[model samples]
Target: MTLDGHCAAEFAGVQAAFEAEFAAGNEVGASLCVMVGDDVVVDLWGGVADEATRRPWVRDTVATTYSVTKTMTALAILVLADRGRLDVDQPVARYWPEFGRAGKDEVTIAQVLDHTSGVSGWQQPMTVDDLYRQPDAAAALADQVPWWTPGDGSGYHALTFGTILAEVIARVTGTTLGAFLESEIAGPLGADYRVGMRGGLDRIAPMVPPPPAHVDLASLPADVEPRRTLGNPVFSAAITADPTFLAAELGAVNGQGNARSVARLQSIVTGRGRAGGRAFLSAETVDRIVETRTDGVDRVLGVPVRFGLGWALSSPAMPGVPDGDVCWWTGLGGAVVSCDLGRGITVAYVMNAMAPGLIGAPRPNRYLAAVYESL
Candidate 1:
């Protein structure tokens, strides 16, 4: 494999670990980027973008960033909050009046951001096709009742988090999530990332779907958390291959970008609210991102987690990571962007190759381990 891009001498270990993933058949096409303060210490990409076409993963190649899209959505809301447009502490009814229905009148935007609003997934009669229709998805979420009490605890709102937040932004600004991101975040930061595909995308990589689930959903006890969380509508990576799915605004997912774009945008958190030479958030807002909202076994992931406003706090489940104060989130298939506020470093790993589970990806962990070791 011909790895392309450069790494500062101190970050040589990071580059080697990235190449090791490809050598071990763990990564087909991937990119890793690390930025300290304003300096980009490492940027590297390699391998085949599309297995069938034998396309190389070029300098500009981007791939689906599954859940990492949530960070962008969350950042947009934070920007709005900073500009005095919306308040995270206000009830949802303050903006989108209809969202107050179905026993959710008291649910605050902060609760929703922290995954504690309890409208985890759609009500019954859901299908993959429904996910492609933004209007229908938004309406269904507005009318649905919470599976748990508002502001009580968290049940990861795997899909609904985006729709709810997007609706709030739309109700406030009359702008779609993709449009706000372009006008405010991506455009300002010179980051090439998008919440949904528009027009044709060039140099994009196709993803390798994750390995099959460990236990058949049908065979699991009906009351189990994972079964309850993932059984409805069922998620398939194959849906991502559809053009319509790519174009539609899913918000929580369907984001497309690479390691460079993610780090460029998220470096704001590490940079104390500035990236690309502009202030996108206040230092106070950046500090709020680590305020603990929930620390318990995640209903959807079935692992211990510490969720903050829009990201996860470093926890024991994700070992080898530095400091509990660091905040991060991941796309499915091992792609992750982690910002260490104390270290003044932001690291991102993006790829077409997917590891089995969403979290604790061995390859990403190894890359991060190498990064801190270099320091």
Candidate 2:
């Protein structure tokens, strides 16, 4: 398949890899984009958005980029901090006072952003509706207590990172995370991304399921944190579909967008906090973000994952380009997004096929390697 406007000769192998997945019926539809500095060198997509309906994937067709949304959410907080409206060092209770309940008065905003606040998952059983109802849901998160000592270690937060950060954003900016993202980040950057989607479901590509073999925990090392956090029985059914799932913003998960927007927004980090003539954050903030917080094995992920501010620092658990200063994160399925500060590049891949893994699958690494090779 021809990759539309992309230079096939330069990106032939990358395109062929995606084509094989589509041809083998491993993926229904997907899109990949690579941004080097300000240029979009590769923008390719193909296949069906819906298998039963036979709807083809088009350039504008977007999907839930899943946890890739966390990068954007993290950027939003950094932007706020840059504007002096928020401070990472201050206690979250300083802004959202209700968060002080349950011995969380000392939990700093940085701790929450790094997933070390210990409020990883909801204590109460959540339904799909609970996720969509923002007010009640956000309040519930604020009312909850830490699962362990705040800033003790990383615990993967999974679906609650968005709500936690959103609450902070609301307390400071007086708006929901979805609204804030649209008005400030996406709108300003000219990117097509959203935390809580508004309208346009017809153009959205539903996620495709991964192979059954990939969903099992026994295949991975028992000591890996991804296996522990993602292997739980509760997460298994949640991946298929849960009523309370897509309702609210799960910053750590459930962010919806395409490859274009993912790369566009994350370019702020790669560009040293500036993009599209806008300064979303400062170089100092970016430096702070790359500084390591916790480098040992994550309590929740069970792997040797590193955390820095709201993004995951590159480690063996999650490798990005050759550059060492890059920060990257992945969605539940195959979606992956990375900001390479050393190379001044950003790469994003979004697909409908939901790979049953917590981190990125092999597909993204192949494309990313090609990107750096070109650079």
How high is the lDDT of residue 288 in model 2? 87
| lDDT scores of the candidates, listed in order | 0.85, 0.76
Q: Summarize candidate 2's per-residue lDDT along 144-205 as a digit string, tens digits.
A: 76777888889887767777788889889888787888898899998988776646767777
Model 2 local distance difference test score: 0.76
lDDT of 1 by residue, 292-375 (tens): 989998877878888999998898756656775689988778888898988999999899878887678788889989999999
Candidate 1 residue 103 C-alpha distance from true site, Å? 1.1
Best by TM-score: 1
- Which 10-residue window of candidate 2 scores lowest in summed lDDT? 232-241
Deviating ranges (above 4 Å) for candidate 1: 222-225
Error of 1 at 237 (Å): 2.2
